[model samples]
Target: MPERSLAAPKPALIEKVLMRCAGQCAVCRAWSHQTICESCLGLYARPLPRCWTCAARLPPAFVGRPRPQCGRCLQTAPPLDRAVAALDYRFPWDGLLQHFKYHQALDLRESLLERLNTALSAAEVEAPDWLLPVPLSIERLRERGYNQSHELAKALARRRGLRCKPEMLLRVRHNDRQAGLKLEDRAANVRGVFAVEPLLAARLRGTSVALLDDVMTSGSTLFELAGVLLQAGVMSVQAWVIARTPEPGDE
Candidate 1:
């Protein structure tokens, strides 16, 4: 009658596409959000019982102990008062992170943030007043075009209603990537690389902080950053990371 619908109703096309998108899981393209919906998350982000101070896997013997921190933390405390990580840095998570951190796949950052968000929600933990990303040095920042940790903090801060102070902690020096270093050498690699902005001294003073990062390998980078915050008069320090690597021998 009215030239019959040559254009296939715009609204119908939009609805069809939107429906397809809605049906696909964020991490895995699938048909079931209700059934295997969290498939990707379940496979890649299932939470593991971890050392309270460092997020290291709890030793088999320490499974139900009263103290949750690892033995090393018991001997000598870590800089952060507490810490937690979403997943162990391996498998699909590692590959996803490589894309986010190195390949300029910015969208993947949100997936990592979701994993961290899930970790915090499932744990009986306190939220910090300030969330700061482990900053990048000027040289690296220029090259990467973005700081994965900062992007993560910003997204999580919105979800948690916390302040994301990406610039509060400044990377004064550039350190080599900690990926390939031996466990013993990792700590030394990041030494003296992070400092807090003097202008924020009063702002950060008395504020509890949670250092944010993409991965916690030896716990050195975050540990170093936490110490700087505490030294600057922050009341307390905690760490929240997208992933925590297993101890060397556990591999």
Candidate 2:
């Protein structure tokens, strides 16, 4: 008699093993399910109604107002035309980001990219002409061995059938990390830190582009990059981030 073929392992089993190896929070190791569990997700990742233009967490008083941008944005507008984020960067979520950015756990890129893809689909926005990941300084890239944002953008572009231009935006200077800094200092830390490749300027002209990043804290980095892209004559710029840190008043 012919030998029988072996049955393949179940997908559920594979997922369970992967989740276990990734630990509870992927970065926090706090007893989560592949970075987050359903209960913790409900408690920590609850969605806050946000301003459409600037992505600021909106209060009930501001809901249904004529303009959706927050007062700050109204006074001093951000450079990018629009922005969207999947979750608030807090608690277990922040831990996950740390793993991807600092711990070299590149495997987390897949899950983060999946979440960003969902945000894009739910927004119903048109796919941009090109996608660019916020670039890192060569020094930082050499130290980290990878740019988490670029990895995420590459995965997103491949999944969505859009072009990913990881090198379009280059980091012109190395800046200190923005974490733990006040909002006021955030902008200064990122100022003059990015530039567009001169040869890529013509391609960006008259084109709409999407900028991808692992997390957006004060949005200073995104704003700086968008400013450069706009100066390069890009028709429009939008930001796509894995998470956004809710402003103090938002809580």
- Pairs in clash, predicted candidate 1: none
20-110 per-residue lDDT for model 2 (tens digits): 6635654435776565555655676555556665676778776556547777887888887778888878766787788889877665666
lDDT of each: 0.79, 0.78
Cα-based lDDT at residue 226, candidate 1: 84
Q: How many residue pairs collide in each prediction? A: 0, 1
Error of 1 at 89 (Å): 0.6
Pick the TM-score winner. 1
Error of 1 at 237 (Å): 0.3
Candidate maximizing lDDT:
1
